[model samples]
Target: MNANVLRYSAFTTDPAGGNPAGVVLDARGMPEADMQRIAAEVGYSETAFLLPREDGTFEVRYFSPLAEVPFCGHATIAATVAHAEANGAGEKVLHTRAGRVRVQVDEQFTATLTSVEPRMAPLDPDDLDRLLAVLRWHRDELDPALAPAVAYAGAWHPIIAVSTRDRLARLDYDFDALSGLMAQRGWTTLNLIWRADADTFHARNPFPPGGVVEDPATGAAAAALGAYLAHNEALPADRVFRVHQGDDLGRPSRIGVTVPEDPREGIRVSGTAVRITDAANQAG
Candidate 1:
């Protein structure tokens, strides 16, 4: 019944920074309930459970403290890096609840995940109203350029682009109300973002359903965002975009997003991971 639980924080070299996740190297023999309990005990935003297949690919499941998620970006990054550190860096295929994900780990401890095909849909007017109310934000605060929409890579996230960085910095939400709305809409997080420049953005994610108030570095949301930008032709194709998150939470993380010309290849979300020490683990 024992499983190897490796702790790694993705999106930053410093263990104290970025988003921390637990990786279960061998979840083959474990039951669903066992995986849930382990994830709850680990108490990170998410933990990845891997069951290797005969073809060298693996079935990957992600569980948060409260429930299972179809996919999780930070956990994928952390788990892939942890796997590479132990098994050598190379391409790995993961069969997630969302779909197939291809990850490449380099020698430098950086892992990049190619998301499933991404898409965006218009947000329901009433749902958007409720979300804005819960966040205590006015319609005028939203950026007119980036309209409200539900974007999906592996999971669905509602993209709410704020007009100013200050609006994004002040993140206060009605947890119960937002959680209720998210549960109803099958949303993983509310991607709150502010466009600082063409290539740089400031963002925050409210994941009340996952039992986390906010995520420091959200790889799923980043992929969705990249898709949104590319789909709308918002940014120059040759440019690299940066997403800065966790600064408000003090864990400050940076996510690098690259959008190639081929839209079907999915966006590239790259980040580094660091091992957490005992003291840091205790504190978290």
Candidate 2:
């Protein structure tokens, strides 16, 4: 690829772990088709292309190998850290298809992104039933305390909480069925979760809509989970929680999420990223 495609692993400091994303720091004037092509060539779950504006802000677009997505949290973090390493670490606004996302880059190059206003919606019973059947999960396996619902924070993800951590670890689902249902509902991912306590949880994300079987680390889903916990009063107000993911897939990652007192405010999802010096490296 002729584009200056940089690779970075998000949510983990080690390149061997976390989700890998492609970042095109200067993609101004490039056609959308070209950006999509680069993302396809890179073969990551998602890639970010940034168009710098005169106001020092960026108009960002995210593309998976198969299609364009409204938002991608991992890609946002990877791109911001790459920019901070070159420019200075601070804050900036990114205009995405979902909304304006505010990002802060610390001196350590850990990027924290505040999502757009989040909202939750009830999942249709029929659809939820079908999803459960596809995942081979029985109704008894669900956690009644955490109702299944769809949550959005820049991107839409269906939140499904299981009864046990063992159930969360054994994730095998029908890709076609899940992908068809997700595409019909415009869902970016299925946020499958298991809560260990008030402040600790484990998660897995199925992103077949992005042509990936599963994502090692999903920041967007983590943000939606935080909003869900807040909306349901499942946790204390103004709390920060930890999400452990991808351990079953051998790409262990950790994500931290904070919910504010205000219900309408965006959830903050923060994590560190490691730069993959070679663009040819495997990520995600």
Candidate 3:
């Protein structure tokens, strides 16, 4: 089956910023191998393939350069905006590998994804130690308020909250070592964060699992962080948080997060998308 692939950056209005994703408008009859090949050929961290549904929604699948993921926030954001433009901006239901996700595009072009139910689990001490060593970080650098844990919102990420922004900025890690650990633990990425205030945060994601050193804007990890914050009651109910990410990578990105009172419903992450120049549409 021939599929058309489009590129767009999610969570930022700038064409050069945010997380870039490949979107397939029609993916009917495409095999897994073809999808994987297309994603790798596109060379984006993740690519989205949409299977249009009869009810005006679509079935979406996410593939990284290396493999398929359960769900991808940035890709979903990108796909939603693309769909809205091709179709119309409104509510769309996405059936993903992880679960059902509902995306809504506002009049201002901000796409918000209401995640699936999120959960968190304590990380084993040994795993945390190994991860810290891989990043060449000492245990003392960790924020006491935010304990290290494994959080999940469609994908699993090891959350490490740093006490200072400087510590988060200097993000150098042993890629091979960290990648090995993530592979062993089945982790999707490492969510490194610096809290700017009770309602604002700065984040960086090490996505060795996706064969990428860093993700410019990570919507899945942002959703996971929002779940963590709400579980701990770290922020007020009326607060709407902002996450600044990808600054150190030169592709500055901003993610908006809102934590509702209900813990059962997943977090809401909003961002705009901008279409960049069509890359040589090289689909394998």
Highest lDDT: give the candidate number. 2
**What's the best-to-worst order under lDDT?**
2, 1, 3
Model 2, residue 120: what's the lDDT? 92
lDDT assessment of candidate 2? 0.91
lDDT at 183 for candidate 3? 91
Clashing pairs in 3: none
For model 1, give the 10-residue run with minimal summed lDDT: 275-284
Tell me how candidate 3 scores on lDDT: 0.90
Full-model lDDT for every candidate:
0.90, 0.91, 0.90
- For residues 1-284, write the lDDT of model 2, one tens digit per residue: 36888899999999889999999888888888898888898999999999999999999999999999999999999999999998999997899999999999999999999999998999999989999988999989999899999999989899999999999989999999999999999999999999998798999999999999999999999999988999898975448999998888888889989888884789999999989875564322
Clashing pairs in 2: 20-284
What TM-score, to 2 decimals, does candidate 1 have?
0.96
Q: Against the hidden reference, what TM-scores do the models get?
A: 0.96, 0.97, 0.97
Model 3: weakest 10-residue lDDT segment is 275-284
